[model samples]
Target: MNPTHHRRRQLRSVGTITAGAALAAVLAACGSTAGATAQNAGAGTSSGSSAAAGQPVSGGTLTLALDGDPTCIDPAQTSLTNTLSLGAQFTDTLVDQDFETGEIVPALAEKWEISDDATEFTFHLRDGVTFSDGTPLDAAAVKANFDGIIDLGAASFLGSSYLADYVGTDVVDDSTAKVTFKTPNVPFLQAAATATLGILSPATNKLTADERCQGELVGSGPFVLSKYDLTSQVVLTRRAGYAWPSAAAEHQGEAYVETVVLPIVKETGVRAGGLQSAEFDGIFQPAVQDQDALEQAGFTLTSRANPGNVQSLFANTFRPLVAEEAVRQAFQKAIDRDEFNATLFNARYAVPSSVLSPTTPGYTDLSADLVYDPEGAKALLDGAGWTVGADGIREKDGTKLVLKLLSSEATKSAAELTQNQLKEVGIGVEIEIPESSQSFKVRSAGDWDYTFSGLTRADPDTLRRDFWSGGQPNSAAHLTESPLDDKILAQKAEVDTEKRWAIVAEIQKEIITQGYDIPYGSQLQIYATRDGVQGLRLDASSRLRLYDTWVQASS
Candidate 1:
């Protein structure tokens, strides 16, 4: 038999081991097991027949449309949603999450064990794995990846946040590696399943962070980066001799599609039209208005609620006018979250009840303070010594009650609607939509009163990455040292399942009570695919996992 056939035969005999049974059981006590079922229920509408029931076939090119150019190809440096969407195709994490049950499963690492204190984790690497560059994937490579991310510092916002408590890693043997943390990092295991912590080859790790961001990284995933044009497109070719795959994966060998192409198409109309005309196999972030038409045309629309902080208008308390707690509370009570979901998202998105979404692991309902009451909002402003002028804008001490709201082109419509809503409550909002890169600069400089954004992750510790002032400074509300920060620290330090959740609940309540994160609604990462495509799935972080995706032979 040929070498490829022999490898397949060997893989068939090696059974897959799925981990995190205890973790899944513990989470079930906190929330429903079918967390993603509600979001995926409308996947292929009743009017259209399911296209996922065909036999898998190989040897076809899958053309996917991206909303914008990926910010970076390096997993550690990628911070944008579009970048994560593409990075998932070429990077393999130590672990993977079960889409249906949210359980951690084996991926690059065959299995792992967490210390009783939850401060240390040891992983057993899979044998015979090799990077696209033909470099061996071993314990040393994993250590280099983690160490490299920590060394990148602020340049790698996501990576730095993920490894904030990381102390060091020790290679126990050729296949065994132990990772140590300063504090009890209960979320580190789940984080290991994310692309932010994906391992790169030793050669790739040796390059400077800037060089890796320019697409010089190598990974051991099913696809290899064949061509990367930062401004235009990215092409990936299937990797041969890849027998190992995650336990959640449908098949264990090479990907069904030989080549995958991701082209940056910023316009929603163009992407939707291309998918409709069969010019593209799939499209990311399909317009809400186009969902009905796309489904009616027999395309499948799949979505999952991102599992971290909801999309919110974060009030920078450090700003002058917003420094007043009353004004910040008024901003939270003034806008109608239900209206925003209805008008902008067509109610397809989930209305968030807390700083964390329902799909998040430690989510708790704190919606009592999030209700919309324009009169209450006005009363709060009035009590704060702000008087409405002839122009309908409130003023106090000769300063106009105007706040600048920063956003990107994608969120311009929602920002405009928010402007009109706040205007009714005697607050003036100036909407500024800047270029993507410049938007980051504006946020980092703290030049805006409010910013629209969200962070995606499967663990509740994502709060630390966003809210911890000592970490990513400008990502979240930019609130330095507060009672909520203390609670977040407490939650991160505790490892007991129930006790940790109690602390997490209190943290969410404190965030809502303080009005730092004024959540609008939960955001769903939506993708639309033409009929006859099968096996496409969304991982826990709501990124597309196309390893098992196949194009069914045309009938």
Candidate 2:
């Protein structure tokens, strides 16, 4: 338990960028303390790729494998990592935050200004940028995208949450657009850098949100979506005459990889095998046990910790088993986080200290509150009048202490482990792993006592989206109106970094202390690439940036 583990780690590398002095003041006031400038230094590239240190060579397809299929490919709607990663290839954001310095830099928008109150953001667009559909990227397009997200409502997922206090976006002129919020939103600039906020062609406004999920949307990115099939794969062909790239990109005219193919390989072992056999150029989320073998065979494993919600099991308060406050607190104490990580994952994963992952800004160290305490758990259950029955299961008022746990294939391992641990304290956990497409339907129906899930974002406001009562895409814990809701709302409007972070810290404390959510381990995005892959780097939000990624041809 080193004290340094609880402190924020410094960014490993540095690069210089020059913006206006006024922008510097905005970074100091709104970005610096809020972790808007914070860049992930935890990205590690293991030895073995043949072109790992070589100069880029263009014109080859990078056939990457994704562990899960994205339900939606629409930038405005998806919140899943795999979906956003795919979208990033075919979509571009308004601005780009530097991966090293976290400075706001030009992308589709050449320059921008933040009002003193942090409510209005004005952007000046670059000339001659057009979507693959021949639609010009202009202020009107930006307004259309924003207005569309607002119209989609919760279906827009992260986009709607990011634009929570949306007032409106004013089309100042052909090139300039001013986006104003009802309250001060310090996180909006960095939010703009995310793929979820990636701009789209105004023609997409005609499509319903579900139709957009079918992957017919056009974007002005380095690649174009040629095909999307749920059962097979999603293909992106290189966009010719493409000149726009994020300021953080290494080098770009068009993506060096000529055509990018993402095959939906749902099994982790199959993905690893595909990479090992050279059937795939890269694979996402190789199993922890397969890491050593993959690296030994000359494949490079790149990893970056996700910065929003940790891999957590959120209690459904509406469920009878977890409805009791004492029972919820007992469930937290009964599980051993260290054992869970050590058994299921390896050193690559971290034990989460708070509801928010350590890589997130405004993360508070709540390891003290999260320590393993089986004896304390037993006592709490006893005091709550639940007696251990002859079958070694807790019982009270003729009801067995069995709780239902909902999980997907990706989260099933952790859910199964949680079930085993809670059994030690006379609690019965019924595991229910549903199909990926059925996950949302099952969760929305409230058929389970606890659901295992996580989210990846660069800001602390992610907590608001997860725990706040009225948060977007629906709250994970299904929390109702409470003091926690007030704090979550307050932090969003408080533009002052220190004060806002203090409020975020309080929100974490309240979530942990009240037993609303139990974080088991931090979520890290890992990819295994074949020997010839080069220049692949992760963006600020841990999504793979493939603009500079190129694969060398075999000699």
Candidate 3:
């Protein structure tokens, strides 16, 4: 037999192991964020055709349409939804996290152990796993990737955020590696299950960050990147002789689809039209207005509420106009989240009750605090010495109370709606729509008074990642000082479930009561798939996982 055939035979013979009893109990108790489910027209219905019977017959191409180009295909370098979805197909993480149960099961690593204080994690590599590039997946390879991620520094936003305290990974042996952190990282195990911590081939360590972003990376995933064109499409071909699969994944061995094609379709209408014409098998983020029509036209709509941060407008506290607590309070009170949702989203979305999404763990309902009170807002503005001028805009100290709101195409519509809502209370909101690539740069520079975005993660540690002022140079809130910082930090170290959650609660209350995060609604990832597109589902973090996804044969 050829070497490839022999390797495949050996890999197929490899057995899997269950996670440690201690770690499994902790993870299971924590539970996952909301499970991602595929429902036709938001009703519980499978996307696959009824006529297509028998087994999952594969060997077809699955073409998915994306809203924008994933400028970087490197998993560690970006947490953007598009890039993450793409990375999930071509990369594998150390462990697999259950979407419904939050159990930390084996993936590339067959088993793992956690230290008593939760500061250290030891992962045992599975036997007979090799990267598509022919590199051995071992303990040394794990160390190299961790070191490389730390070296990427701020460039790996999500990765850097996950690995906050850098100690290093120790190669105990060829298959055993121990990861250590300076501070207790209770979230590290769950973080390991995220694509940001997905393992890459050690050979990729030789490439610069830029080269890696340009798709110069290799993984032991079921699929390998065959073509990556930033302007057009990304093509993933099923890796031959692949055997190891995540324990959380529904199936074992190779992916059913021979090839997966992701084409950038900037216009939602264009994507919808393509799906209708059978030009695309599935499309990401189909507009709310188009959801019903697509479902009526025989397409299935799969949606999962993105956990962690809600779609919120964060106050850049450094901005002059928003520096005063009164102004910030007025801004929060003026927002009619109900109206915003009814008007813009056809009331399909759940209005935000707190800084964290309702789907997130430890989410506290602060709807009473988030009540829409325009008169109260006017009172706050008036008391702050901001008088409504003849132009119907608030003015104080020879300056119009106009706040610059930074937004992107994704949130531009919502921002515009906010502008009108704020206008009612005599507060002028100047929406500054920036290029997608420039959005982060502008926010990081503190050039806007308010900005809109959301972070999706299963854990509440996402709050610290986005809101904690220290170490987070790109903190949207621009919080120089706050008690919330302490609460955020405390939650990370508290391993006791009740204690950690209590801290998380205080953090959410602090974020909203102090006017740091003005939430609008839950962030939901909705995709439309034509019939016969089976097994498409979102992972715990609301990212697309195409491993078990298959395209049914046409009758």
State every prediction's TM-score relative to the real structure. 0.88, 0.86, 0.88
- lDDT per model vs. reference: 0.78, 0.79, 0.79
CA shift of 433, model 3, Å: 3.1
- Worst 10 contiguous positions by lDDT, candidate 3: 41-50
Candidate 2 residues lying further than 4 Å off, grouped into runs, are: 1-52, 101-103, 319-323, 396-400, 433-438
**Candidate 1 at residue 170, lDDT?**
99
Error of 2 at 435 (Å): 5.3
State, as a TM-score between 0 and 1, how close model 3 is to the true structure: 0.88
**For model 1, the run of ten residues with the poorest summed lDDT:** 41-50
Backbone clash count for every predicted candidate, in the order shown: 0, 0, 0
Which of 1 and 2 is the better model by TM-score? 1
Candidate 1's residue-wise lDDT over 411-498, tens digit each?
8877998899999999999998888768777788887888888888878887887777665454677776777778888787787878
lDDT value, candidate 3, whole model: 0.79
- Measured with C-alpha atoms, the lDDT of residue 540 in candidate 3 is 70
In angstroms, the error of model 3 at 160 is: 1.0
Per-residue CA lDDT of model 3 for 1-555, tens digit only, reads 565344334323432121122222322443423322353221122221212225776688999989888888898888788888788888888997675555677898898998878889999999998999998999999999889999998899788888888699999999999999999898998889888888888889879999999998898888999999987999999999889988877788889899999888766556655665567888988767666566555567677677788888887777788779999888889999998888777544677788887666677878899999999999998999999999999898899999899888768778989999999999988889878777777778888888887888878998887788884456656776677788888898888888898999888887887788899877777887766777776777777888777887543
